[model samples]
Target: MNLKQFWQNFGEAAVYYPQLAQKMGGVSAAILYQILGRWLNQSSTVQCSLKEITDATGLSEAEQKLAREELKARSVLEFKLMRSQPEIYSYTLNFEQLEQLILNDSAVEKTSTVKRDPYFPPRRQPIAVSVTPHYQFSGPWRSQQQLEAFQDALLSYAKQQGYSNPGGWVFKIIDGISKGIKSPFWDEFIAEKPLGSSQKIQQEWEIEPGVPYPAFESERIQYYTHKGEPLESAVAKARSELRNPVKAKDLWEGFLRKCDRIANDALKAKKAGVETPYLPPSFSEQSTVTKASVMEKLSQLQGDSSLLEAENPPEKTLSEEEETSSDIPSLESLNNLYQSPITQNWVEEQIAKHPEWGYTIREGKVIDQYPF
Candidate 1:
């Protein structure tokens, strides 16, 4: 059927039949007319199924059935289900009855002679047109509980970071997630820092009295690495010293001087072929030393029992060690060690040494040890 021609005809008919237009002033009526109009240009009768109506109108099965029944009651359409296949139905457009109803409505409208102002024109009744319905899923993709939990986590994080308004950000994040957008940052942020605790320290440095401002990024990074402090702690320390501007300036100068001294000591140690306990200022500093020097230090540490003992001593006694061991590698190292035969043997030996612990390995990794 030519939909454009059918739509033009339908509009003209509505003008000629104001009552018919008024009767079709609802979504269901408009939908029914659209469906019937599609078949009218081709033939009076068309065979179809409920699914076809749903696909064409984007209405649910229940909505389509209700609309079909409404049209049937108004004597504008007729349909009968096939006896053999209940799903299939034959529809007939009752154009004769529709014309008759339109004429009757027009006659009734002409009989009502309502007076109008000379300057005011009569307003025509608006006809409802059916466009494609846009369906929005009401519930979230995830469960309500899970969504709420994530929102709470975001809110807590915002509060910790001193956000003036967190609801707006939380709403956007939740809305994005509802639309199937993944939030990996949310997962990582929640894992690294607890909800109520700030992950990054808030820092304010002072160039003048009572005029505190944020520290430079380079200075903040240097302070965090050199002091072996978390970003949040380093920032807090700097902020605390800002109350007294002169004292704060002195403290910063002292910190810079300490870094210079440490750097000089490390340089002298390198010349004397002595390994310094202090870490390099940055990875770039390590590159300044020869590869052979770095490897030689590693080789020496591997051979020297004293250094190894200082880092990780052998378990003294079961009474003292119990389930924990000073010699046990970190969780990160154990994860890597899980794939090694040597590490596996070492783990088995340790388990044998402490039979009371009832150590076990599952999926090629120790399962009985407490995971930190």
Candidate 2:
């Protein structure tokens, strides 16, 4: 790549390291770009000694050392020595890999904090009722006298069991019954009476997050928050510092640097006949190639026969009038002319606007303008 292209690509790579950009400033960033870019251009891969980097940058010996250390600290480049000479060092960072690394790191940091208030707010009572309604009797008919007798038996049972309130007594009784015993064992035991053993019942219930217990009173409830929410929301909410959020940017950059490391390692692994440590990044055709460019490529490779074959009938030729009247369109024409349900309404509207054409609807269908 030319110096301009190198800078652009290098800039893409440097995006993985936010702190490095800040540390190097614009001028130093340009220099680092030259140093790394030159190394990549000279060798099939980038791996260089200190002197080679200096030679590439045209910086002094002292300046070369400083640059090496700075790049290493910022993880812009990694160092390796094939021989003792300063220029004998070999290794380079892949900018694309680094960019993805930064993205992943930022993703991780953002997804890791708790943000919601734990305290429960007061519950609003229904305005029309003026009182909390209880579950009314909805079962088979029972006379008022039968209901009164049942209530008395329940109340006496509660007093015998030393439960101060009916709610507590009912709670225990229901708990025992649900646990598979026909009688309330806790009440009988508390009352100093012995009853036959009952089978142990195991009931499994799943509590949905934030749902209050039906049998329990009070507004307070326990709930589980998604683990990723706390850090993710916190990182998003925190304001940028130093004209931008340097820490977040740095993490992102560091991630990119790691990506570069992975990419470079992959190249080395290919050379060494070892497996690459990571799968490299991929882009969709829509993302990397424009529609115009794609069409241009297809046009260059096109043949008249191939084009003819793509049409509905491969073997037939059109008559002069048929060819002249042919409304068949190219891919581009199809894309441009694509219409949806909304377009139907729009066309009807236009026809309605023209006084010469009277459009009417019969039932659900348009009554006029049938061309086919």
Candidate 3:
């Protein structure tokens, strides 16, 4: 068939395997056309390895694999060993050509010349490629259980949003944590930081933050849309719409879970005479004091009344000396006073956008509120 006719048939096949059409590049498609057309005209098998085809067509290995699968899936080509030499044997379609009428000519038919194995047939194994975008984790996490809790929290959030693959979603979560990738979760995590403050920055600036979490791809099957939409789109949608704001509100809850796990590990570690005690901020929050009160007490410990006033204080009461003294500065302090409240409000606004956690931990137990 001519290129036009081939494409027409290929387009018809795309309803079932849309990725074949979606992933094909110009060179790879051309190579498919050339190889199939030549085989039809010459009536013989073609000897070409993946490297040779890539070199001849100037296509990359990835593109060539895509094209090869596209043709194979359509039953246009077959890969098998002929006399112990790997070769691509072209199968001619009965509708595309006329068979010779003479009895002797029947033997010359390409279909008759081809070999088949009934027991062990040539089957294509799908290659696992990284199609999802990278996710990275930030902040401090000392134990594996704490890390796992965070991952579980993300998976729960994604599933609640109707995602098809919760494992894949969890892979993205772990991937993000290991690589320090800037995700919506991290965006929300840093939102509460004090203004003009630099948050905990990772050391290696050159590293690709989106690197897939180690063992993540191997541990689970990646998600793909039935329509064959790119995996990246699903991840993008998950980070922005499905998981973000909800994940932000779930931060303290996730942190608490992580803390419980950390506390268990810490108890074990302490029994082993390990001095380090790992506790999430939520665990600290559980004591009779809140973060605000802790900050107040810490300020008192430091003997800095100004620090206490900055964190918590009664309504403003300016002394005549502080009001009139140019040495105290006014405009800069006024700007800071206004800016801090606005930043705090914005952080609270992001938290307020989160969807309520509705997943069941088990039967009759659902996480429906934050900071539990």
Candidate 4:
């Protein structure tokens, strides 16, 4: 049904004349004002019936009573009971008081801005194309336990998305660590089996009746009210989110696990006297890199004289600043090979790309808070 077709004209300023509905209390009072305002045709007073108000604004009779009490307390309106008519009431509005309220609020806003130097109003976040924002960790600056948690969470989330072995999904993340994790076959894998479609809505619309779906509620309001989406479409979107609440954190952990696995492998190969301890970053067909090539080249593996033909790396003196094979590879040594200055710049780039981590990186220098 087109609810807008039956819309009535009213004072727009009433909703936020003094402050927002949330700041003032609830939207009940503001909604009450709109209903009464529509009936006042060049008159301050209007006879309003509770039944009529309830029919116009979906507000119950008890809600209307509380709204009237709030409006009277704010001095924006005064209502009197009509004799012999329990459902009817006469409302008298104060236009001067409402105008004064708006003027005072505007003055406060201007003064606050002037007092606060270097003030920047909050920027509206860019709309996400996906229902949920995905988080990825290409570097292993975190603990092994944390990495395992990320892997488990990622696999669980991918399962929810109906993907079998979501390692390809994790591997496609824009970093050189794709070959490190469960993504040796990533190039041909996800291309063949893409992520599955979202789950269907419940045939019975009773997704735990009486309990409000919090994540779905936020999405529903944005879609239905702000984006002007149809009620049916909004309901479907909300239900989908309610079922699949999180995706980013899962991906974040999974990729981190892969990086850690790669780092551990490199450390083991280094200790085993392997000539080429590290895998080449690229895994494309043109790239002359294979897991078998590196595994065969391992000097610790005996009986392969052909693989032994590979030349050893030149011996280099270790500086105090340089880490040995015994030492766990720092963020700089593994994924990021640059020094502090360049590494710090990369941190800023990551923050910009993943605005979802904005809260965690706010307190200190972005790199400081990061495990790196």
Candidate 5:
């Protein structure tokens, strides 16, 4: 057998059907195909023994048999067993059938938009629901009455922390504690405040000496007025600075620096006669832009007369054109047409078309052929 010829055939087959190795029983079948091609000699048929195939492909006897069965089932190979030795078979590669199957599979794959491997199961999507901070516990409380009571007490504790709605995080914390998931926060919270207790918990958990809870809305407004900063920016900066405990003096200093920069910018803009873009916090408190303003802006941008007309349209009345369109084939004209002999003949012809209707014309008058 010519090794070069065998390799050439193998490469050609691989190029023609790139997925063949995987689709047709994997590596062992691919190796066997190449070995058979080497012994093919200018003919489609190759005479090979089971031992020869096993030796060439390094597949066990069982694997070799399975590969042959898969190749035949795929219409890529056919073989005839010899009468003398069933183990030795005359094999023929159905090149035409193999090529056809490959083309058909390719066409099918191209038509499918969502490509997924047939070998593996599809993955499931995660369940998602909107959770709000202010949501109260509404429970059936059948077997979980204790959990519900604990949740109510947790909500009361959260309210003392200035959170109107303690949010989903509180529930997650409580759930973790109930499930025996250990955490320092859970340990301290539970130890300091027992379940169903309305009394204030002791201040065992202390904030650092000079650290303060973040600034309130009133303080944020005061900072915005003094600093000439955007109220949003001032609020965001204060929240960021006080997110974790820092020295109270340090937090105040950061706030002051931000205010100084903003105030200087405002002064510079005023000196240059450039109007400051930042609005006062009071202006921000006003109601949002009305729908009419939005519509006016859209009309201006689109430059559409129809949109403007639609916004403040006049009372509608039927125009001459609409009135003329409505007078389609007057009733008197339709009655005259119905009295004509041509109309009668056309109607009779239509009835004659359906023999199943059992209608017959006798002396120029129609009647049902079959009557119950």
Candidate 6:
């Protein structure tokens, strides 16, 4: 019994597809593949939602779309949209295609020649939306009308109960109080806030963050936040400090120094540079020289002018070790290629420039950008 060589595929609980990962040249496609494998275990055809797939794979909505395309192009899987409302879809794996892919590559591939992946992001925890314990529907919702009626009932409950800010969670409160009863003893009862609720992206803001704060302003807030200040408070304080020239100057210097330090580790990436998994603070990938870092460096700077670079330091480029692979395009690489102001013509230009990307994929394929 070759224990290490054997795979316990029957009871595989976590996400991975090593051979498929190698073939896909990245993890997103491999993750989607494993998720599909799990669904197929139940039946020949399995139907599920995009959210289910996204939750399992931990890939963003954008990355999930790309993963499906990669699997399709590789001829390893088929995905079809089953329904629209609430988004139901099904995937079928082509086991024969997968077998051939592994067999052919395994037959001739030398251990020395096969490249190793530099970094693999850990699986992000699924943010499952679970109903709180002791919570159930207010009434039997056998028909769509009953569900609609619940809304009117909720408004009446709110008015009768004098609820001020419960417009968002009326259903949550109603469900908990009703406990699946055909009729509750009272029309309205106080509902405790659901446990494990996600924090609002922005709390009731007392200061202007301009929706997305300016880069330097954001860094200033993050620095304070890291030090345990509330986000809204941080914004107010950051704005006030930035208004002072002396504080702002000190912060900019500190920002430059901080960025220089981070860039060194990121640019010399182990495999494709940006040593850290996911995004990094490199000029080639993303600039750490944003307004926020600058503000943080200057506003709260101590005696540290000697160690930092000049007013504007040279941008760090990716090293030989971090250069992007020149095979079938990875989604991340394609995304980097298709930067902001992504129009159809701009996408086409990038495609023409990188002909290899077009070999397996159509020009401008799956490069979804806003407004185009």
Q: What's the lDDT for all of these models?
A: 0.61, 0.46, 0.46, 0.55, 0.60, 0.59
Encode model 4's per-residue lDDT on 120-215: one tens digit a residue: 765667987865457555454255565555455556557776876678754453244423543322332334433222222332212553233343
Better of 1 and 5 by TM-score: 5
When summed lDDT is taken over every stretch of 10 residues in candidate 1, the lowest stretch is 303-312
Candidate 4 lowest-lDDT run of ten:
196-205
Backbone clash count for every predicted candidate, in the order shown? 1, 18, 9, 2, 1, 14
Q: Taking the tens digit of each residue's C-alpha lDDT, what string does model 3 give over 15-120? A: 1223323323334654654554454555545555655555455667687667666655544445543566454333333222222222234566665767879898
Top TM-score hit: 4
Q: Write model 1 residue lDDT over 113-188, tens digit each, in one string.
A: 7777779878887999877688432334355566567678889777776888889878777677557776654555
Model 4 / residue 201 / CA error / Å:
90
Q: Give the TM-score of each candidate.
A: 0.25, 0.21, 0.17, 0.26, 0.26, 0.25
Give candidate 3 regions above 4 Å deviation: 1-27, 39-41, 81-83, 86-372
Residues 283-329, candidate 6: write the lDDT tens digits.
23334466546533542343333112222334656663244233234
Clashing pairs in 1: 201-232
Candidate 5 C-alpha error for residue 336, in Å: 64
Could you tell which candidate, 3 or 5, scores higher by TM-score?
A: 5
lDDT of 4 at 292: 43
Q: How well is each residue in 69-175 modelled by candidate 5, as lDDT tens digits?
A: 88888888898899998778999997788779878878888867777778895787688988898854343223456556556666766776677568675777666
